[model samples]
Target: MGIIQSLKRFFSKQTETSEKNHDQALQSHYYKMTKDKTFRELENFFSEKEGFEIRSVSEEHGEMIVKRTKGKPAFIVVTIIMVRPFRTSVDFSVASETMLFTDFGSSRRLIYGLYEELNQRLTFVGTGLGDELAK
Candidate 1:
């Protein structure tokens, strides 16, 4: 919102999707489903992508680490957790590999793109429902 904050974000090399994030597009997305289905779908989703690579997958922890090898390299960690039955939460952490400190919002854009693609394959409920949904 402010000039300093804008500059900091612009110069940052990483961005993560969280519920409390000020940017709506960067907020964690909620889905009405289970972790198993989400995990499988995500594995397929990234594996099918041209520039992305599934580096590691841990269904036990509901986490996946992926790397983007082409065009502006970046390492992405996708966390998928089922808060409760039929209510799952997905969050993303992206770190860009570049000469400068900034990725010019590329990390944020990548997360947004992932969310968009997953929204199409899964049942999206809402974003930032950790407090209210858990109860």
Candidate 2:
């Protein structure tokens, strides 16, 4: 190829490589967030409960998997997934027919309890709660 063509190809390849590297870096950052010590503690706490199971766990995607059982359903189903960004200034969610936030663990408990109650009610009726309930 000519000189100009060769230069263009070289620059194009460099741009592609840079974009791939950036994407990889972002993925790694997300993974670190998911595997954070505090987050893991929460995951373990939920996973060890008698009536619940973890469906999936991922820091990169900011999602926590949970499964719950309901009497009317006659079968267990995945429910109550949690998601929160790692670098956000505050944590908040709209689930269980309400919105909640926390700067301290105390508030977190209240929100979680409320969510559980809502989940129980909805699940009892054999109606699935939408993502809004768990956000």
Candidate 3:
């Protein structure tokens, strides 16, 4: 592959991998997978690790929204959805802070890395979340 093609493939990772079927299935599979701490943990994760400030969370709905508090970050729009008990599906959408037409997978790397950490810590979900979730 050419350098540009490789960069596009790596950087501008598609959005389809964000919400997965397995993630959907996980929700209905359990009534209380690991208690309702998933969203809370997510709130904490984004804040403590990514330095994202929590904007809002609906505990009843099991969802949260977080974003960068400082200058414009590489990515924006973080949505965490608890599809089912103990199953949380996350989607991170990026709008480059600069004028670049494409990113070198910075967004994908950020989200997937954090997702893997979350899967590891959460322990309810399996690994990688899926390479599909990344480049």
Cα RMSD, each candidate:
1.2, 20.2, 7.1
TM-score of candidate 2 relative to the true fold:
0.31
Checking candidate 1 for backbone clashes, the offending pairs are none
Cα TM-score of candidate 1:
0.94
- Give candidate 3 regions above 4 Å deviation: 1-16, 19-35, 69-72, 82-85, 127-135
lDDT of the candidates, in the order given: 0.89, 0.33, 0.51
- Show how many residue pairs clash in every candidate, following the order shown: 0, 2, 2
Backbone clashes (count) for model 1: 0
**Least lDDT summed over 10 consecutive residues: which range in candidate 1?**
126-135
Winning candidate number (TM-score) = 1
Candidate 3 structure lDDT: 0.51
lDDT of 2 by residue, 19-123 (tens): 112222111111112225435654665566555566666676545645443211111111222235432111223112112331223322333453344334332
Model 2: residue 69 alpha-carbon error in angstroms = 2.2
Which prediction has more favorable TM-score, 2 or 3? 3
Residue runs of model 2 more than 4 Å from their true location after superposition: 1-35, 70-135
Error of 3 at 24 (Å): 15
Question: Candidate 1: global Cα-lDDT?
Answer: 0.89
lDDT of 3 at 40: 65
